[model samples]
Target: MAKGLLCSAMQMTWRWFSPDRTVTPRRQLRFPAYTPNAVSLALKSISKKTKCLPFGLRQPDRPLLLGGHSLDIVHCHQYLGVWFDSRLTFATHVHYIRERAATRIAALKALSHSNLGALYSVLQTFYSYAIHSIVDYRAVCLVEVLESLRLSLEVLQNTVLRVMLGAPPWMRLVNLRAESGFPSLQHRIWERTTAVIAQLCRHWPRFTVSVLLQRTLDRPPNPHPGGDWILLAADIVRKLDATNAICGGPDLPDPAYAPAPPWLPPLIRCVEPTTAVPRSSFPAVLCQDSLSHVAALSTPDAAVYYTDGSVSDDGSAGAAFVCDEWVESWRVTSSVSDYQTELVAILGTLRHADRHFYRCIIIHTDSLSSVCGLQTQRYTDNKYLTAIIAVAASITGQGGEVILHWLPGHVGIAGNERAEADARHAATFPVPTFQLHPSLSLLLRRVAYTVRHLSWEDHQFQIYEGSRSATWYAIETAYAPVTVPHGTSNYLLVSLRHLRLGFPCCGQMTNSNPEPCPHCFDISEQPLLHYVLDCPATSRLRCGISEQLHNRDEPFIWQQRLLHRHLPL
Candidate 1:
């Protein structure tokens, strides 16, 4: 009877699993078997290429034969780059990642050598792509790893940072991380784990993992010997105050996998050049002239619809469409970004046009991103873009036409202004919910933003408060837009960073009893500040700078000058 049941199960598996002849048992296979009898039966009918790994605490007492050959019992196996041992501890996988990351760190050190002349940004990029990627691969599985193993990964990150910055070994890890703008591995893993949880929550019922997570949350707490990723993720969500943010509603659609249908009518786009002069910079008269030109180009009999989307300060999103027939507005989930809101607005316009069978529909929107996305017809993983294409194709396939016009927003256009106002109004007041799912990209972005702010706060209290860097911290608020410009030489970039961090190698900073300035004999205690502002050695150069400032009639603030605010000149 057991043999009959086994044969029946194998037949069913072959029939359903390989119905299309795409998968066959003849292919290379390795499976973990829970029982010795099952392993024996599986090996007898399988190809010699197959390998069986017996699981559970009990070992097979006797050797099992398959075609007169004894089967080999395996203790470890690799699948999808992750090693799984009989104990399921993931220690082997972590060790493998450490070794691989160490090799990549060596490569980074070679490239960042002084003779190679690689820029800080280039080294950072290599670290992110080569070293960090290897460490971050499948990090969600490492949540339950030993604390020692996790710290080993962080040590590798510190080594990479030191190589990139060429900082002394005495430098603090917090300062090095802040200087390089890289978060700690722990924070990164938390961010990644939270992002995955958000995605699973956002697409509940679609993924099996999501279903299991939901079940785990609903059940009474039980001891999990192997550690529970779902429970860990839930704890993180609560700590982040994102419990409400990740709750999935019943109305969200499953992601569309099929390609967009072809449209019969050509999509007409009147998009302005991306590099055109800024509308904000245009004079009032020019703005009016441009608006008039846009008004004149509208087809007399065609339906002209204006669309706009708004995002409030608190992250609530709203989209609205205005036309001669009606003005409609609705709010969407706060997790949707302003860009996706714009796409939703345009999508609404197309849906309306298709419903009423309008012959020619012209949509005026302020979102250049939406227009460009439609123009390119390359919707890569964006479910909204895919749906928009599908709807537009449906409209055009039925002999109707859709035209998209990109217009500068808030330029006193009547319909556009009404749409924008309605969108903002919808965002302010409770309106009909749009029933759109939270975007995965936007959710991940929120996680990243929260992690960055948390890291910054930690840095402020731990590193900035008790260090010599406090001097720069006091004055940092004075410089509103202090940023290192792209393409700066590595030497200048490093110098500026050191100065901002209050560790410049000046005599006063480096010595307890500093001597007078060697070049100008200045006796000021703050030698770096005096050297830039009052040194007679640089009098001729200062004269040229003062003349330029005088010509521009701007005040000569020594702080701003020292901060490289005038470097653009």
Candidate 2:
């Protein structure tokens, strides 16, 4: 499974390795006259001295000669537009990306301090569309490489948004990301990988499949053991196989051996053109915390059942059961999510505990939630949780005892890999009936999420429709739309709004009704416009405001319009 998963991941990586997209010096590498041109025209034309960058596994302190010219390799370099280090750890890459992104953010800060018209909006566009693309490019590969680097990328994005909103740097980042419509760095990476995987599964691109197949055909004994991607690729191949189950001899799969998930949502919505039907068993990618599963599985006389659940792009589900020598799988309905299916597979595995007579059986799952659910029983209110509890109750009636273990998916554990493969295979099975009965709480939460998203979008639309200033548009992109300017002016704007709505001014909201403008001690009602634009005490600031509009002699009507338009009170 590890071998296969590795091949699959390599395929994906290679597909993205488009030659045209690379920013390396490779285009000139193959040039016939490259060496002489570099010593002559290239060096003479350059203002700064040229440097050399090397990649790959072989490391040497000595420089390499290119047409008799020695090129020295330093510690870090950029390749294919992403940075790399001598160790290929991507640490340098992350640092380069961060520094470059920070420069843009600092530019934005400078722009804001300058108080240029519509500059905030410009910054917003730069961050939202352009900068994000720059930082997120090929992040799918880099994200899985290091957690710290992933967080760094996220922090960079947050810093950009925080600057635009004039928000405190110490603001809760999670809440801030959520409010600003930015998913966490990790989530964005996950989402992208998931989409790519789904596309790969759906299309089964010829080039990727052919290349991977050719590589696996060699299958040398004691092959180079790398990471879990090999196992993941193996699982994928097995699941896609039409006959000759990867593990179960050379015979075709047996339909009678298959089983379904113990529970599913009561209400299922059917979709047309479902996922591809399963041809063979499959498993999932390796997960984090795989070592625990490895350590626990080392016990003797304990049979490991790698069970997994999968949901396809169209929302169809499949559950797989992989015991020693036997592989069972079945397609399920939509309504149930990938996470729910994983938990449901665990429940099914638990119920099957009575069938297997092993003295100690290990039910291994890649789903973190399922493991947590079994331990905490937090999902008791949900139907799936109830189903899990019911199965768990019957466990005592069976053999010695079944231990539920959380095995990180895709790490290439034999049993776990088989289960994940089978589950994914089941997901592709074409089914006519799709039934689901979602628990009320589960249904409500999904609905609420959708509603909240729509409401936020609608609110944004209203703000856009009501205002024309680019600055407001940009700031509101990260914050709730507000007509008031940021800084101290926001306070004044909010207070003014309250006063207009029949609420007393800031000092004390007593029966004294509306208080006079405290700043100017005016006898007239403390209208915000008078205090902000026409008050004698504020005459100096008013002149500055007039100068901003390009002339101190501008009419009072212009000042009123500026306040009314921008302040919107």
Model 1 Cα shift for residue 345 (angstroms)? 2.5
Candidate 1: what lDDT? 0.66
10 residues in a row with least lDDT, candidate 1: 1-10
- lDDT of each prediction vs. the true structure? 0.66, 0.50
TM-score of 2: 0.34
Residue range 1-569, candidate 1, lDDT tens digits = 00000111122211113223222234333333324676677733442443334333335455544345454545655656776565566788888988888888888877776544687878989988988887677778777778898888888888888888777665666667766778888888888777777766665556877776666556554555346667776666655555555665322332532454467333545555444455556656445765765676677768889999999888788999999859988887675788889988988888888888888888888898787777664565456777777777677668777778887776677888899999988887665488666566766777787777776776677644576454343354222323555655556655555554455444644677667887787678777656655777655546657654333233224324544543211
**Which runs in model 2 stand beyond 4 Å of their true positions?**
1-75, 110-123, 196-569
Separately for all candidates shown, the number of backbone clashes (residues 3 or more apart, or on different chains) is 0, 35
lDDT of 2 by residue, 132-201 (tens): 7775576545633566777777778777766665555544443344344666555555444433333342
Candidate whose TM-score is highest: 1
